[model samples]
Each structure stands twice: as C-alpha cells, then as structure tokens.
Target: IVYSWLFWYHSQLLTMKTEASVLVEVLDINDNSPVFENHPATVPVPEDHTVGDEVTSVNATDADSGFNGEVRYTLLGSAGRFSVDQETGVITLAAPLDRETQDEYRLVITAQDQGRPSHSATTTLDISVTDINDNAPIFSKQQYEATVSEHAEVRTNIIDIMATDKDDGENAIVTYHIVKQEPSSTPLAFTIDEESAH
Candidate 1:
C-alpha cells in the first residue's frame, strides 16, 4: 500500500469509493394441487360402454411459472377400470362396470409439476359403478358336494363358500361345494344357494 500526498491545503483529507455488486432472493407460492373440477364427479355409462367413452373430468392449477404450472393427471387405484388424460384432465372408462360385483370405487390421484423442487398434490376420487345386471352369478363351491342323512334335522349347519368372476358371463355360474362329516366327522347337512351357505 502506498500513501501519496496531494495538495494538502490545511491538513484535511478524504477518500473515494471503488467497487459494488447486486444480490437477489427467490420465493415459492402455492402453484399446483392435484385436484379435480369437483371432489367427486359423476359420469353415467352403460355396462357395454365403449373404450373411448368419456367417464369424467378433473382439473389442476399451478401458479408458479410456464410449464411449471403445467399439470399431469394419474390414476392411482383400480387402473384397469379407468384412465385419465394427462393434458385434458379427461377420464375414460377402460372396461365394463357392475355395481353388484363392485359397487363403488375410491381412487387416488396425483398432480405434479416439472420444477426443480417438484411440487405435487393428492386427492381422492369417488366413482360409483352403476348397475347393469351384467355380472353373471358365480359358484363358490366349484366341485364340492355333501351327503345328508335321511334322519338329519332340518336347517342343520353346513359350510361356508363364495365365488367371483371378472366377466358377467355364464362363466359366473353359481354352484356350491359341501364336504359332509365323514366317519371321523360328525353329522350330515343339506341346503344351498348363490347368496350363502348353511
């Protein structure tokens, strides 16, 4: 460092400034929420509805920035039953629906943004599967049968059973299986139905 003396009038002196710089801070706002136009939207459809049939619609909003505000839709549960369009927020029925077999569906959906810290939101969707009598009856006791004694008391307890099928076709035919009490077993039984066992 060098100290030079200029025109020192009355022994008074002062200095001038030299360099400077600027800084900035960024903040985040509520940009997006994985939500639908309505919490639970409804779409009436026939059991034989086409694949392209529009099931329902949902929408998401983001206040961040371009593309950052862009949202994508995703169906989290029972996907084979329905689907969502990422851009249009439109949902379409993927397969046939039978309220008898599966009355209603509760779905989880997410909306996410393409950002550095990526933000997302989750929401539940209630889908009511309308009835169409499309589901055929299924036999729980496929190939099982029981022998009842001639003197057996009426309404005697038998066994428990159930059945299910993906299609509403005759493949859903109802039948039952009953393994009667053997020599090592106790009494015999009788009675059957598609609904229950006794």
Candidate 2:
C-alpha cells in the first residue's frame, strides 16, 4: 500500500508571482514477506540421542518494520516426533528415535510474519538417523539340542548357532561365548567358536 501527498507553495513579489506543487509517496510497513536463509537443510542425529535435544536452528528475515518484521516458526511432518521454537526457530527432538523402525524423517519448517495478512515461507528439513548399539542379539530358536559322540576329538566341531542384531555397523556384529556347560566337567567338555558360534 502507498500513500501520496501533494503540497502547494505560492511566492509573490512586485509585478511577479509564482506557484509550485510537490508530490511525495510513502510505502506501507507490511509490504514485504519473510525469507528463509540456507533452506532445504539436512541434519544428522544419532539414534541414541536423548529426547528434547536441540538438533538445529532455522532463521528468517523480513524487510518490514515493527510487528510485520517479527518472525515465528512452525514445524510440520514427522507426526510430532520433533518440535521447533516459535521465537527462536530451534528444532528439538520430541520423541525417541529408532533407526531400525525408521531411518530418516522429512520435516517442513515454516517462517511467518506477524502482519495483518501474514506471509510465510517454507523449508525442508531432512533428518538422518545415524546408527547406534541399542538392540541386543536375538537367537533364531529359544533352545537348541545337539548330540555328540563320547570319543569325539578335542577340536571337533560340535554345533553351529547363529544370532542376529537389528542394529547397524559394529553394533550388529554378533559374537559367541560359552557361559555354562552341563555335567560340570573339569576340562570343559564343550566349546564354541567366538566368530562362527560353532
């Protein structure tokens, strides 16, 4: 919106008189929209990251003055998994994250001005959930039955047992250990390979 004003001035002298008009224009303060900087951002968060942790911050600027230039933030998507501060634009984790269930999330952040007809801008936030050692190894069967000959050699293979972990990277690496043995033999009658669980 613009307002225009006209001013008229008259000058009189002996035998001469002159008149002039001048025009001036004024612009409204709520004419500009909010703009985000460095939009379409991507952030990486560990799966074990605690809830209410600050992930990142978003910023915007408005050319208008007073309330029209004030910016507020809003977060969309992720089903309430995350939150953003309205005045600061700081994104925070609102719930626990599991990489096995969902590895990534797409969020839409909006910045709006406090004008009469508010103007808003949106940006995409790609949150990548990193791997962590949270899941334990789960065996395929609850119990195993194996029969071995009494005359078996010392290093003979007994049985192969396997377990898998849902985590990624080193967290998913499964190893085997012999915790107890039946009959309580003095020399340890059974053993398992650490790598192959045999």
Question: All candidates' lDDT scores?
Answer: 0.64, 0.87
Model 1 error, position 163 (Å): 19
Compute each candidate's TM-score over C-alphas. Answer: 0.49, 0.78
lDDT per residue as tens, model 1, 1-198: 223333422423645434434344455544554344554554455566677788777778777765667788778885588888878778788777765567667767788877656788877777766545465556555675556677767776555566765554454555555545444434443445635544
Best TM-score goes to which candidate?
2
Clashes of 1: 9
Model 1 residue 28 lDDT score: 51
User: Clashing residue pairs in candidate 2, if any?
Assistant: none
Candidate 1 TM-score over all chains jointly: 0.49
Model 2 residue runs over 4 Å out of place are: 1-25, 151-154
Model 1 stretches astray by more than 4 angstroms: 1-37, 41-45, 133-198
